[model samples]
Target chain A: MNMLEVTNLSISFGGLKAVNEFNLTIKKGQLYGLIGPNGAGKTTVFNLLTGVYKADTGTIVLDGQDLVKLSTIEINKAGIARTFQNIRLFKELTVIDNVKVGLHNGTPYSTFDGIFRLPKYFKAEKEITEKAMELLKVMGLEAEANFTAANLPYGKQRKLEIARALATSPKLLLLDEPAAGMNPNETAELMNTIRFVRDNFDMTILLIEHDMKLVSGICEEVTVLNFGTELTHGITADVLNDERVIKAYLGD
Target chain B: MKKLSKSTKNSLINYGMVIALYVVIMIIQLCGGLSNSMKGFLVPVCIYVIMAVSLNLVVGILGELSLGHAGFMCIGAYSGAIFSKLTEDTITVAPIRFTIAIIIGAVFAALFGALIGIPVLRLKGDYLAIVTLAFGEIIKNLVNVINFGVDSNGLHFSLKSAMDMGLAEDGKIIIKGAQGISGTPQDSNFTVGIILVLITLFVVQNLVNSRDGRAIMAIRDNRIAAESVGINITKYKLMVFTISAALAGAAGVLYSHNFSTLTSAGDKFNYNASIMILVYVVLGGIGNIRGSVIAAVILYILPEKLRFLSDYRMLVYAVVLIVVMLFNWSPKAKEFKEMVSYKIKGMFAKKEETQA
Candidate 1:
């Protein structure tokens, strides 16, 4: 069953349509990719999906709940989480603290408990720290837990963002260009890490990427978009070989 | 935040020595024949320290510029002052009224913070600043129009009649006008003020270390990324802003009671006070709690302490503030750290060469 269903999603900036009639169905625990050239409205789709920008006309159903009416935090509470295209780690905060932010959405303690450092606060904080550390360890970022985020290397920063998103405990995770600036070796490692995160966390993954190689290597299914329109969709192998996707990507 | 380097630890220990020296100054104030009136100024200075530090949480930690701080403070002060005044006549209701007033003030400030935050926080950068500044003005003007006094007939005193009663002078009584409210009961003491300072410190510290606190900071660093990560940036930001405002409101209650006067909510709530607090945070180091506290104390006290300089006192103050900001004298300042480390290295190098 599809965990997220988007039909005829479109958004516009004044007279210009940024994303038009985009549709995708993501099932639970399925690893999927959305690939297209620049201005294919890839990031715009992510924004529209996350409720950062309301779809001008579309229906977004996540876990059987209509997402169009929810606020950003409400969307998160509804079990959808994502990461940015550019690295957006809290630079002044420690790595563990960054992950703890993700865990905060679901923290069960009250503000009163936190302020008074009551038993619940202590229990909650300890649990959060342990959970954050576990996620960081899974991402191979445990050693840098105490360090400020800006001090981490580029690959580690990307991992930190994923670890943070995972801390939110979402059923479906959206990654926006996770491997954008990485070298080949780093990209391969990221691909492995993404798969590992998927299996270990048991999460449905949807990512937007320009790297056709990474897209084809890890994604079980693929969707292609061009000029804000859906160009094609199917299994990664078959969809990637389609002529429309080729022309949209290569422009022969 | 790391284990302070050995030398830095030693330097911190030296800071303890500086505190000891300051203790001697306090001793001199007590023993060197300074009048009690001269000591009265210390109360406001302490209150300002609390106010500025709490305000810094919003301005620095959450990284939002808030001009509505004084408005929150005004809310606390009025709520507290009214509680104390109304209940003081009945011994049975007085303490409870007073207690409830403070708690009520905090709640009011939080509600106001959320109310104001919804619309104002949607604005980003300088637009946020401008909206907050306007909110402060609106609050101040609202207070100006409000008349909270009851006449001899036991009816509420309107602004026009209250102004005509003139200044009610009984020893240290100090306010009188639609311009300001005076004759407020002076019931705050050092114990209450200090206890409040400690409370504010505790609440702020806990909030900053909590999950919600980090979420707020995450939103602050990058809204899109924070949202992408399911942080619910707006909720967290509003939460922190409300908490910060409530704390400032509590500080205001303490200030109102300490002075036995209210600065006509309209008269004193302005952008200047907000900017002064902002300067304290920046001069100290944004997001540095101890830095903001220390900066607040210095900024508030140094001005009065230098009062003997007469007119030059303010000149000296301006000069000192300029020097601190320009020279980077605060502890967390990069330049200040460099200068101290450079001197420390110089000292250590001499010792090493001499031992060699």
Candidate 2:
């Protein structure tokens, strides 16, 4: 069964259609890429799917759950987690605490349990700490778990954002410009990390990227967007070689 | 027995310091080292500590500037005072009555916290601050126009004049406009104040270490990221705000019960009072709970202790404030403080290892 399906997704800001009639379908465990030039509304698609933006017209079904009317937090709980175009870590928090924030929903303790430090609070807190540490270890950030996030290097900060997202245990992960500020080496490393995440977690991913190399490297399928509309979509190689895709990137 | 974790050990040390300060004060009191005036300030010091610590939950942990904390304090003080007055004859036990009054005050303040938080929490930064300031002013003004009395006929209320209350001839006026509540039972003592401070610390510290607390700090650090992580922003925001306000209300109960006469005046429960609490939180370090406690105690007593300085007392107090601010914010001072704390922690760890 398809993990996610969007039909006729549309949004407009002051008569300019930021995203219009956008449709997408991804089977379980598929690694897909949404590539577009500036102003193509790639991020807008992610925002709409994640409930950050209210769609003018559309239906977003994730694993048979309608995500349109839900809030951002509800959509996230419904199994869609995303990273940002800009790295957004809880800068003052320790790296592990940043991951713990993602694990918040999974814990079953209440505010009273927390205030009183009930047995469940301890049990759940210990489990969360273990899980958060495991995520940090997965991202090779175990050594830096106690460090404040803003103190980390740029590349590591990006990696931490992904780790934080993965900690949410989403059925589908959305990456918006995950490699925006990375050098070639960091991008290459992120490509491997992304592949590792998919293989180990058996999770589906939808990535938005302006970097052609990074997108074509790991994506099994690619969707090209132009002026908030889908231009073409196919296997990675075919879409990259399409004449329209080239013109859209280079500007006709 | 299992060895204590580093974080747990650190927190134990923090609590130890608070208890140690209490012990020292007790010893000083026994030895008659404190003047009667200083003894009078003791309960108020504990009250202020509770206020500062509770406010930190909002200003520091939740990362929302609340200038209307005094408003919650006012709600708590008046509600608690009135509850005690109405129950004065019924609840013969002093401690029981005081407990019920504190709970009533906290609940009432928490309700107001939820009411104000729902609308203002949607706005961020300076806007939140200004709206909360307005809330404080509104509450203060509302109290001034409020006139109420309680008697065998139950409760009577009026917004205009006390004469308009239309109560029985023997109806006792509980609140008389700007004059506020008078003849409130002074049932609170240093011990009760200390217990309340410890309770506030326990609740706040435990929350800070729990999953909910982490979520609160996450929202403060980055609201968008917190939302994307499946955190209910409204739920957590309201939870923290209500809890913080409730604790402030508890402090208000302690304050009101310590005095026979209580008024919602500019000097007592007004905008400046709110700012004073915020100053304690900031000077203590925004998210530092222990710092808030220490800052409140020291700052509250500093001016009184410097009374011997007389004419130059406030001048010295102003100088001391500047130095503390610099120490907190300056890079070199921060490094020095970190080094000192690191060394202290290292010493404790070594001692534990040797004992093991």
Candidate 3:
């Protein structure tokens, strides 16, 4: 069964159609890529799926539930988490603390428990910190866990964002431009880390990226969008070689 | 008990020190050359500390500049005052009556704050500031037009009859149009004030350091990202706003009984008072609890100390806020890094010391 299934999803800004009749499906444990040139409505689709923007039409189903009806937080509770195109870490919070925010849903402590330093609160906090640290370690960010997110190098910030998303225990992860500003070496490392997280965490990832090498190397499945319409989809090799995908990139 | 971090342990010690210091000051005030009238200033300072600290929760952590805080305080004060007056005959015990009044006041204020937060919190940044400011004004106007008084028949009467009834019978109780309410019970003692302050400080301190507080801060830092990661921004924002309002309401109860005579909440809880509390939070460092509390006390006391300045005191107050906010800008990059390094060093040192 598909982990995420979208059908006839559409949104419009006045006369401008941002995304229309967008549909796709991916099975569990799939690593998929969504790519297009600038202003291709790629991020717009991400926004709609995450409830940042309400879809003007259609349904999103995940794990046999109607996801379109859920609020963003509720959708996340149902095992969907995302990172932003522009790295949006909680800049002032410690790196580990940022990751811990992802674990807030799982934390059982109430306000009283935390304030009074109740035993349960401490136990939950300890468990959360340990789990956050483990995610950071897998992402090669264990050493920088105590540092503020804003102070990290750009590539590390991207990885930290992914680590934070992973901390949510998501079944399907959405990443927007996971390698926007990375150097070639940093991008290669990110490719490996993304693959490692996919296998280790047993996750299905849907990512948006402009880098063809990273997208082609890591994603087994790929979907292409152009002018808010799906141009092509299927295995990465077949979709990447589509004439429309190339023309959309070459602006022909 | 779970193992405590050094900072957590130090915070506990610091809280104990503050309570002790306040106790010493109270004793000195009672025993020293200061007269009873001079000691009255402590009541107002404690009141401001509660207001500043509670307001900090909304303004600092939630990252919403709320200008309607005094409205919530007004609601609390007036409701507390009215409740105490209504139940005075029923309950002879002073402290119990006072506690009931404060709780009612806080509940009412929290209800109103939550109601306002629902519609107003959707607006971002400056729009929210303006919306809250208007809400405060609307509350003040509503309080002015509101008619609340009971006659000897124990029947609720309008302002006009209440005044006429006052003059006809024993001229014991009187409240003229826009005039202050008089004949309130004087049961607010320093002990009660200190206890409530402790509760407020404790609750806010815990909230800021908890997962809920961290999520609120994350929402403040990056709304889109926070939402993407599954945080309900609206829920957390409204929760903090209501909690802050409830605390402000508690402060209102303490303020009401501390003063035997008071005017309609219109005069007492105004825009400037809320701004003053905001000034305290900003001057103290927004998210720093100790800083905001100390700032509140210092600012509240400064006016009294410089009473000789009289006409120039307001000017001085404005200048102080401006100077502090301007100079204590965001922490420098190097300093922040050093602070992090220090935390790490301290952590290792504690580990080694514990082992030894």
* Each model's backbone clash number: 2, 0, 1
For model 2, what is the C-alpha lDDT against the true structure?
0.91
Model 3 lDDT per residue over A1-252, tens place: 799999999999999899989999989999999998899899999888887789989999988889887888888888889988888999988898899998888888987798787999879988998999999999999999889899999999999999889888989999999988999999999998888888888989999999999998999999899899999899998888988889989967
Q: Which runs in model 3 stand beyond 4 Å of their true positions?
A: A115-117, B1-3, B6-10, B30-38, B151-154, B159-177, B265-267, B330-356
Question: Candidate 2, residues B1-356: lDDT per residue as tens digits?
Answer: 89976656766777787788889989999998988998999899998999999999999999988898888989999999999988898898999999999999999999999998898888888999999999989988898889989867889999998889998988999899988889999999988888898888888888888888889999988999999999888888899889999998998999899999888875778888998888889999998988899899999899889999999999998899889999999999999999999999999999999999
Residue-level lDDT tens digits of model 3 in B1-356: 88886547746764785699687887787678667655787777778889999998988888889988888888887789878877788998998999999899899999999999899889988998899888887877666654555655553435453444433342334333455466779878777888888888888877878888889999988887788778888889989999999999999888888888766554457788878888899888887788887898888888777778989988897787776666567467547667889999999999999999
Best lDDT among the predictions, by candidate number: 2
Each prediction's interface RMSD? Answer: 1.6, 0.7, 1.1
What global local distance difference test value does model 3 have? 0.84
Chain A TM-score compared with the true chain A, each model in order: 0.98, 0.98, 0.98
DockQ of 3: 0.69
Better of 2 and 3 by lDDT: 2
Cα TM-score of candidate 2: 0.95
User: CA shift at A221, candidate 1, in angstroms?
Assistant: 2.2
Candidate 1 backbone collisions, by pair:
B149-B157, B175-B182
Docking class of 1: medium
- Predicted model with the maximum DockQ: 2
lDDT of 1 by residue, A52-136 (tens): 8988899999989999988777888888888888888888888988898888766878778877768997788778888999999
- How much is A249 displaced in model 1, in angstroms? 1.9
- In model 1, how large is the Cα lDDT of residue A199? 94
**Tens digit per residue, CA lDDT, model 1, B1-356:** 65643323543443453355346647867687657755675556557766776877777777887776777878777777766665565545544565566687788878898988887778777888888888877776666655555433443544454554333333111123344556556766655665566677677777766666677787777777777666666777788778888887777777777765676543456777777777888887777766776788788778778878898988998888888886665556777679889999999999999999
